[model samples]
Target chain A: MNIKKNFRVILPVGVLALAAVAWAGSPQILQPAGPGPSTASFTAINKVFTGDWQQYGQLFTSWQGGLFNRIFLLILTIVPVVFLLHYIIIGAKSFSHAGTPIKFFGILTRFLHWLAALSFSLLVITGLMVVFGKFIGGGPLVMSGRSVHLIAAIVFCLSAAGLFLIWLKDMLPMPHDILWLLIMGGYLSKKKKPVPAGKFNAGQKVWFWLATVGGGIMAWSGYTLYSFAAPVDQIRQMAILHNLLAAGLVAFFIIHLYMSLFAVKGAISSMLTGYKSREEVAIMHSRYKI
Target chain B: MARMKFLCDVERCIDCNGCVVACKEGNQVPVGINRRRVITIGEGKPGEKSISVACMHCSDAPCIAVCPVDAIYQREDGIVLVNKKTCIGCGYCFMACPFGAPQFPSGKVFGARGAMDKCTFCAGGPEKTFSDEEKQLYGQNRIAEGKVPLCAAMCATKALMAGDANVIADAYRKRVFARGSGANAWGWDRAYGKK
Candidate 1:
């Protein structure tokens, strides 16, 4: 590589690394307020509770306990109605099932996808139930809902990892993905237009990355909450991260659900049958050599 | 009219961990979980100070706010208590409490969390007062018995004060006045402002 090109990448990375080291090593920053007696707990509870982040921790707690439930409620109730209005206005892109079908996915791919989807739905439902547990007058039901949420998280992890490996190539950002995004993936209209997309469109790619990579982060943050022995501030940070990312996931999940189930007639059958009709492939996957 | 509260005087606290043991002896909390802990800052160094902290049984307790199962509740007297049977041990309350008052028996990564336990402010839980179920699940219902919590009562130096909020504040104010240093004795200027 040219020296100029190498320096551009290396300089920024070096600066960031040095800054991190400086921040961590500074006696004033994230360092204990002063040298204390050696009598410290393994969890560093002292340093944790008395940090600048405590203020932000309060903000996060409010968002998680108070705001996130309303956010989810709005997503669950309002988002679908919006999609329904879209469906009513633009109508489903119907394709004849009698047409010659092309192999869009194999059985293995279908299994991985369904596993992730179903478990992700379970996670969403159980997590929301837990968030609304107080309003639900929580007892044994909400308690078990937490259990279901954990189990669903584990299952989602396995499927997400598989999907990450299987779909990484197709999900990579292509230059024309910009064009697909600009035209809204040829969605939002009743016109049958050829979209610049390969096996997966830009919207699908965004969801794929979110479901795979974002799901990984969700699992990590969720695990930290589950088995938390971290410094107290870390818990707040992780909770905020987990819940904030969850908000995005929830919105996209709704979009994906409606698109597959109703927005495009016969779209749901493709994953189940591992095939798409010739018309759908032509319109949706215009760049694919069908 | 009596709003229960906890006040630990940093001036008198000696880091003896007596409150910790007293709580364990009285509450019989789950092993490996200390509902009350002494956090010593500047240990072994000059100006080293130890503070005994637990659930202050806050008027608007963060733990109660964040509990997903509504297992944590606050009585009218402001003594926050937890219903152990319903606690899913999701640990959100544990995360929310800056004091580290919430305790979990086992925090292993692969295993499910056991129910959280915390200082019940000696008022016990939702179970009937002094009922066998209350004693079994929550270890004691001292408030109904008209006694101070075991930790504060057994404190040798009287650093840990437990009682109504007004009473504790009055007692602390008298202590500060008796010392004749005004607000400086209590670090009021640093924490709040000069009088």
Candidate 2:
């Protein structure tokens, strides 16, 4: 064998000889004995209620109280600022010519929309007060906030149900919606290029779906949390889901507010007066059969 | 200043529930609520253990952190207490507590959850110490009187020890030394240490 190969073979034998000598002094490793009752035994016995699993509830609390609240506060602060900047830059879309106004939203549709809008606004306000009212007021504020929130939640759920039932068909995705989404719904384009859309654009459909689905989740989770009948783990899970969905819905609410008030010229009028100018509709929603 | 704590010797606890009864009697905790409970693990088994659990009054209490209305608070002496007047009965603290310490008086659905109740460590609440209202709403204020909690004082086997952390810890160390083993303070690592 070469010197390098001979050294490698000798090295393994030398190490093994040293290991055997070392192991001779201490033949076996034993677990240490400690004072008092072993927590391991207790934990193994009560594994379900008191173990590493309970820490998950603590983790959820940390996330909800620390990170989730901060995210909500950030959204509440930044969203308005962002929307205001966009409004300043773009302003509200306006038409130079006033075309014949066409009836778009019927009485029942507008009624349902406003009902949902009003109840949702109340829920948001009361919910915020409950979460953040300590900074502004005291115990009474929180108590009142919670009381009002309960009532508002009921109204919001009912109105959401009505809105979902009435507008489900119109809000479904169509083939042309893909093209509308591709061009950013013609909102960002400097050129007057109206994307083909029905009465509801792809963006509006997204808002509708989010509101309906997210609202459903909020209602169910809110009821579960409010009931206090579920097991502690399930209650905790529901609370986490409720906080997350509420935060997401708040974000969508801001976007919907911006789109209605500023992004589309006659969107608010269609909801309020049940009418949209024919020219405005033709430019904004080119595929609508007015 | 003393940082008060509770150390339960699981080896000595026999699950007699004397601590639970003593706590209930001392605090006059309402009919539907329990401030403390004794949980027996692996009953009739060889390594069976019993632990008397209440609020650990944790160093960083999740209850205080999660209370939306700022109802839950920790005293300078490290006992966690709740203001029943401020608690809204929203049950946020109930879900947040890792030990499931918080209890609501009513199980009625939709808005009838009374104020949240939990172990006060016999320290009472924001109400005047030893006041009738405090006694009614929050049980006893034995800590204010410089006495051990009713539950600890009433423990049959002396399993539940309560007082200043150093003093109780030293006593526990002595017991463990005398016995030469079985010194595990269950939940101590979780309540006070990262481990």
Candidate 3:
């Protein structure tokens, strides 16, 4: 083995080994007595509560927290939706040349795509934090960490709204979109059917519709729970709706990932480099002149 | 080594709010947030009784299980507390708690939900000694000074007792025997137990 190759591999392993040692030495759990009201230790606990009461005010009394929570959720839900819509509403091309380049929308769409991707990742991370609860921290820690998660979600929602404005036009259904859905359904059923030639095919159109509907549900329910402003019954109902919508999004992504990776090889290159090959363009979208 | 606990003899409680007031004065706790509150079970009824409420500080606290940031911690004495510096003010503990002990300073309006607030069992926060801010925000720094809670000491009727559970229970037993069969030893059983 080359010395350089050996050194590169050994360096990372060595760093990981040291990190493991350091982590092992970190403090472990040391439970204290049931902290009943003590004559002496009263001050510190009181300080924390004072600031918190002034900050939170009446419970579930305001809408700002709810708004912050809703915004990020909207972003996470909307961006994937836009991409799915484009893939469906805009025709998909199978790459004939392995290295060929194809162009969709130039710089503008690419910028929007990146924003959506970032927000989606944050939404998932922060969303999981909320769902899992304070297992990540003890009572006091969970109390504070929850606010950060909610704030990040708000930022995500704002970005999602921007994405929706930018890409909604391209996703409007055309005449062939409906036919493509039928033909695609037939193909999935393993039946003989005419291949679609249009700006977008049927399966892609279905994804767009799902995104629009699913995104709205996720946004509404997520906002409701984060705010905790609604009646207790309504909040619980919203929690159920939020989780269900999240599951739906995950299911949609699984199929999307499969189609992009193995089912249609070279499909991801367009997303990777923002272009497609001429042969793919002709085969997939012959009805529309480039 | 002791697994500490607080057991209030509800019958002895007078609903005078002394425990609540004692906690606030002793700890120098902030206004509008009572670390220990007096709760009356049967309001305006013959069967009415009150008990002082605070963190149960359970063995397997759900708040510790759900905190994503690892802010809350159980001390060697079994008291649970949050590292305010590390805490992100998320309120996950508030949801996990069965007793609604964890509270937030901010309410629902005007971004007041700035940070999470909860009872600290009179230990104050993770601050050193007692500064003016600490004194104002939390209350008295008596735990560091090695003292029992003020509420127990300030009980006018001598009903609320605090200390090691075994020690308090023994004290209560002696008091029951001293009554010489005239009064019900465990008041709850005599008044509410039988038809």
True contacts reproduced, candidate 1: 0.33
TM-score per prediction, in order, is 0.86, 0.85, 0.56
Cα deviation of A7, candidate 3, in Å:
65
Worst 10 residues of 3 chain B by lDDT: B184-193
* Residue B38, candidate 2: C-alpha displacement in angstroms: 1.3
The sequence of per-residue lDDT tens digits that candidate 3 reaches over residues A109-212 is: 66665565566555665555554443564344444444544564556566556655554444445577666665553334332333555544556545554554
Interface RMSD for candidates 1 onward, in order: 6.1, 6.3, 15.4
Q: Which lDDT tens digits does candidate 2 get at residues A1-290?
A: 46755574467558857854553322112122232246555555345444533645777778767777787899899998987886777667776447668888889888888888988888888877766755754455566667778887888788888887787767767889999889778776545666778888898888887788678768777887877656566677778888888888888898898888877666687789988887777877888885
Candidates 1 and 2 compared by TM-score, better number: 1
Off by over 4 Å in 2: A1-40, A52-55, A96-99, A189-192, B44-47, B107-109
The candidate maximizing TM-score is 1
- Model 2 whole-model lDDT (C-alpha atoms): 0.78
Candidate 1 is graded, for docking, as: acceptable
Q: Higher-TM-score candidate among 1 and 3?
A: 1
Chain A TM-scores, per candidate, are: 0.83, 0.80, 0.54
Query: Candidates' lDDT values, in order?
Result: 0.76, 0.78, 0.54
Error of 2 at A214 (Å): 1.2
Fnat of model 2, as a fraction:
0.41
**Against the true structure, whose DockQ is highest?**
1
> Which one wins by TM-score: 2 or 3?
2
- Residues A1-290, model 1: lDDT tens digits: 46755575467558857854553322222223344322332123335453433655567668766788778888889999998898888878887666779999989999999998899999988888777777777766776777788889999999889988888767777789999999998778789988899999999999997888689779877887776645556667778888889989999999999889998898999999999999888889999876
